[model samples]
Target: MEQIALKAEKRDISKKGTINELRRKGKLPGVLYGKNIESSPVAVDAKELLKVLKTHGESALINLELEGEKHPVLMKEIQRDTLKDAIVHVDFYRVSMTDRIEFNLPLVLKGDAEGVRMGGILQHQKRELSVKALPADMPEHLEVDISGLKIGDTLTVGDLKMDEKITVLDDPEEVVISILAPKLAEDTEVPTGEQAAEPEVVAKGKEKQEEE
Candidate 1:
């Protein structure tokens, strides 16, 4: 849990157009708040924010500097424009390093599963794990080794090895990943020429009986 420094400035929330203009100016519109502090509208350099996100990921602990005051914050939500694939707004939640906080940590799968190499399908059921821990004890992500997995094997949250300081909040029985047996292609049966002509012969026999 390395904390990265970010600078922000207080912004006017009275006008929505001002926020759009801020984005046009390459400033990311965001808000900072905590359990004890009031929600404050702020803006930061969009490029700088992107750099931090690229380097440290969304789970990175951020030391937000606003008006000469520093706030230890976590990125709570990021609103993006789907059509343009651009980030529109972001929410920063302030945190206390000493207090236990709950957040979703990313799960990373490492190594190729033996089952997959043997023509089995590998399914990743859970991508993130819910955890509660002190900010200082938080990990960037959890890694799981899948090389030992065989067909029909499953890995659950209970199987995860983590620090004692971090408490997993998700159900222990929840499956994280599993190796399934390979799907077999269905065999298609083609009708022989006589089989296909049987219906026509039956119809002709019924026609002759009706005439008689």
Candidate 2:
């Protein structure tokens, strides 16, 4: 994974109202925590963080530079403003290159499925895969080829090919994608004028019997 540099400053204010004031000045509140490291509250430039998010997405490795010290980190979570779709707060997890990390990588379909071209429906069952690997061995996304898939065929987790350094944490039998055969439209039986005619009504307890 590619790493981008981000600068953060130690935050002294912890109140919600004070954080809102910091945001008004183009600062975003965030926390950094990791194994064997002290958790610290910090603030980052909103514009710079937005740029990183746009270029690297959520899974990118970040080089967080704070107080003249550099820490390799990953974005764990981001709180956003629901109405404006803007980032409100962020969480960062410090990481080491030699340590194994679990990441949810997106699955990208590489080719058009043969079944889809043949009028079959292509169903994507899994959008992401949980994988554990060294930080340096992590991938931005996993590519799944679907060109060879035929109708009624399914691609499972076991079918995926990955680097030996990475291990998938999901079930091998789990389906990732499948091509379903096209459904045949059912025929509706319409009533003709004679068949639509109402039958003659009989009084209660009185009914006509069929003659032999």
Segments in model 2 whose C-alpha atoms lie over 4 Å from true places: 14-16, 187-212
Name model 1 segments beyond 4 Å from true. 185-212
lDDT of 1: 0.93
| Least accurate 10 contiguous residues by lDDT in model 2 | 203-212
RMSD of each: 3.2, 5.0
Q: Which candidate number has the best TM-score?
A: 1
lDDT of 1 by residue, 1-212 (tens): 88899999999988769987998899999999998999999999999999988988898899999999999999999999999998888899999988999998999999999999999999999999999999988888988999999999999999999999999999999999999997665445567689889999999999999999
Can you give the lDDT of residue 103 in candidate 1? 90
My TM-score estimates for the predictions, one after another, are 0.86, 0.84
Which one is best on lDDT? Answer: 1
lDDT of 2 at 141: 85
Task: List pairs with backbone clashes in candidate 2.
Answer: none
For model 2, residues 152-205, the per-residue Cα lDDT tens digits are 999999999988899999999999999998877544656657655534333322
lDDT against the true structure, each candidate: 0.93, 0.89
